[model samples]
Target: KSFLSKIESYNITGKQWVGSESWITQAELASDERKNILQGAIGFALPQASIPGLREFLLSLKPSDEPQSDVIKAFWEKFFDCSFSPSNTSTMCNGTEDLRTVSSDYTDVTYFRAENNVYKAVYLVAYALHALLQCRNGSNPITGKSCVTRNEVRPDLVLEYIKYVNFTTQNGAKVFFDENGDSVAQYDLVNWQMKEDGSVEIVNIGQYDTSVPEGEKFKLKENTEIVWGGNSIQVPRSVCREPCPPGSRKAINKRKPVCCFDCFECPEGTISNQTSPECFVCPPEFWPNEKKDQCFPKPTEYLSYKEIMGALLTGFGCVGIFLSLLTSIIFLTHKETPIVKANNSELSFLLLFSLKLCFLCSLTFIGRPSEWSCMLRHTAFGITFVLCISCVLGKTIVVLMAFRATLPGSNVMKWFGPAQQRLSVLTFTLIQVVICIFWLTINPPFPKMNMKYYKEKIILECALGSAVGFWAVLGYIGLLAFLCFILAFLARKLPDSFNEAKLITFSMLIFCAVWITFIPAYVSSPGKFTVAVEIFAILASSFGLLACIFFPKCYIIIFRPEQNSKKHLMGKIPP
Candidate 1:
């Protein structure tokens, strides 16, 4: 009655329930209290000690109206004293039943009274006694008497039985002992769930076996089997920081655990590839791939005969070769004709042969770059073009001397004879040979991978070792062509019946134009396209020499038989 009196007078104030430093307020606390009380009333009702605290907590709500009073009365009616004594001192409600009284039957089992450890201990003692009884009858050799002493028991026999002890107890638990006498420990992972009425139940979620390897020892059910705290169903974490993502390396804090680290980006030419502890440099032959997290072998590039640009350049080079061959055949077939003979037929033959070699030299540039190809391609091209230009210079001098020898007092032809013509051609061609020999001996072209021109591909190409040497070879050829162009331009109006000065001038004009345009195109192009541009310039200039100089002569030799005679070619028309 005194406990009930304290509950009836107790009151709750907002200040008493207000939270000082958290989200929980007085209203939330009161609501939780009511929820616990209502849940308890529906299930098992409040225990004896909790009843007074619950009653006072409800009174603290301060109900003033009849509706509030009726609500409180209904809540109070749900809670009645249901405890029963063996003397029948308490009343038993219709819905209330004790778990012990509702069962059909109960059986006694050894597991309920004694745990598994007790069975293990009993088995250990029994094995020792059995071994003692068997070995107790054996007498010591020194005594020569029936020995019933406890010290006479064989320790080896006792230890042997204990190592292999295996049996099932009356409780159905299997008992076994290891050689070391240590019991293996295994445990069930439990999930504790709190009920709305402030009661807890442990759920067997999984198990851990010490006999298995460490990594495989613990196993759990699905995540849904465990209940998490607060409102989230996710597994809670207690990490110092989030894990670093890929393409970044972790800077571990030596003072903290491995999980705590700072993330930093991988440096250039290096990659982390994963959430790694450190970054590694890529191999020299490899470059960072598109994602920048991995290294891939760099693409090998060259002017290949199989590719589009290479095939096209090869076809053009073949065409130039065919044209030069056909022109040489026309000149050879008409070697006796005045037009062919008048141009110093031997020099013309040498020029056509050199032009054919020049066309074929461009073929070397259309294949994979190698040390041999790099050295041969440039040197062959330089030597062959010099030979062709020297022949042209020789023809220009012959034409000039022939026109001068026609004068009444001139003996220029006798001084600059065919021997002099051959000597001059050889001298001009030898100068280029010496230059190329020095160029190859000093700094020569070689195959190199051009990495900067294009990032995605490695340009497998010939790198000219000496810029000065390369330009010197080209400048010497240009100077000879310019001198021939000027001399031929001066003798363009010569009255010879088969003058070739005009044709030489026009061919040089086309040759200079092609090479001048080639410089900028070669400089601006990239990768395989640079090789393509060079091949195009070679074919263009070679074709210019072949077509402009010989196409007219080929037409005259094939169709104009009357013009081929020495009488008609010597400035004397048929009468």
Candidate 2:
């Protein structure tokens, strides 16, 4: 009581105070002024049990009762402040508060009973005496003769017997002391709850029994509500720092306790939980959320017709197809014109058809890649380009052969006539068809999810199952294009009224330049930009071939009809 009063004087009552068993007992007896300071404190006390007939024995006490000691009579007079005798009934203690009536000082009957340890000590001594004086047959166990008298009993002998005492009480409680002469540890968790009348009540909230196994020793009652310090119902925070939340880790402070730390957020692409000390890296197919608390599946990406780039490429492909068809229409309308008939008009029509196929093949590369589309995009690109190059090669050879036919006894025209031109185109295009077949049969292109390109998204692209097969297909197309460029370059100086070889040479130059630059650009492009680069290359090269080869013929046929006559074609009207 004096220590608590000193703590309260220091204004330190806000903190919880854990006290011994005597602390609560004195708090119950102390005045309200001295006890109210401990209203929200918690303490441990010896567990109390009901003593049989104890309440009735305390209530029946009287000063005039027979066989009452002088101590009992004197204590009764001091308690009631009056004397009592059987002879003088008028002066006897009456109308006064007794043990039967509840008062401010006496609340419950169990508190008045002897402490549990006292009963266990008395039983220990009784059991020890029983063993010490017990006789076996006609001799005592201690003396090995007649039963030993009380005079022969020694304090050391009694102490030795008390060390081994083990017995159970009538209340079914086991009583035994350890080697250190201390009983098993057991205590009741008590909380000092303040009532509305400004009185403190010690509530038994839980128990701690050392006799039980480890981890099972401390237990709280389910129905009891603990009263925290400052009469607050909520538990108070006692640590120096709060715990770190999810999506963050703890950084311990320098020269400080473990509880004191700072919270740092997890890095990108990783996540952390509330209890984990380190961040976890998300899997390749997953990405961390904004808060870094969890992982989610990554978004898939592909070149789609809905995006701006894909739409613009699609539109350009359509324009290329329209221009090719327009050129074809002009040639068909002016089929017998001198300019159309001068150049091999049959190969011109075939070349325009192949250019149209080249434009249409680029559309297949725009949508989400699939098994069939992946196979079709590369194969169609290779074969259509081969066909288109073969047509240009045929035209170049025809220009050279026409000039050779005019020479003295030159039979080149018959050897490389229209039949042979068609056979050459068929042979060159068929080689590409065979290569495509072998590529598909051996190791075809297939769709795959590319995860390494980006951390937060999946790139849906075509995987070249066999790098050798993909490169071979591209190499064959390059070979045909190079051959056409070489042939057209040699025949570019051939004399003719409408020299188509010069136009073929210029078109092949543009084709070679575009594809040559496309190699490095295609290899270096990333994500969906790779597909866009290939599409741009296709459109640029196809436009180059179409504009250089056919736009001049269409212009002269439509706007310069007089220059398209047979006299101009035979070079008679050129001067």
The residue ranges of model 2 lying beyond 4 angstroms of the native Cα positions read: 1-13, 18-39, 43-53, 63-71, 82-190, 193-199, 203-227, 231-233, 251-254
Q: Which ten residues in a row have the lowest lDDT in candidate 2?
A: 104-113
Write candidate 2's Cα lDDT for 1-575 as tens digits: 56657766876655666777776644454445544456667877887665556568767765446444887666565566566665453345553447665443333566532466677778889888776777788676765757656788877777777766788777655777787887777778888877766567778898888777999899999978898877778888888888777788789989898889988999889888766767889888999889888889999999999999999999999999999999999999999987888888899999999999999999999999999999999999989999999998999888888888899988889999889999999999999899899989999999999998898999999998888887887888888888888988998877667788889889989999998999999999998999999999999999999999999889899999888998888888973
Q: RMSDs, each prediction?
A: 13.6, 6.4
| Candidate 1: residue 316 Cα off by (Å) | 1.2
Error of 2 at 501 (Å): 1.4
Clashing pairs in 2: none
Q: Count the backbone clashes (under 3 Å) in each candidate.
A: 0, 0
Clashing pairs in 1: none
Per-candidate Cα lDDT values, in order, are 0.69, 0.83
Taking all chains together, the TM-score of candidate 1 against the true structure is: 0.64
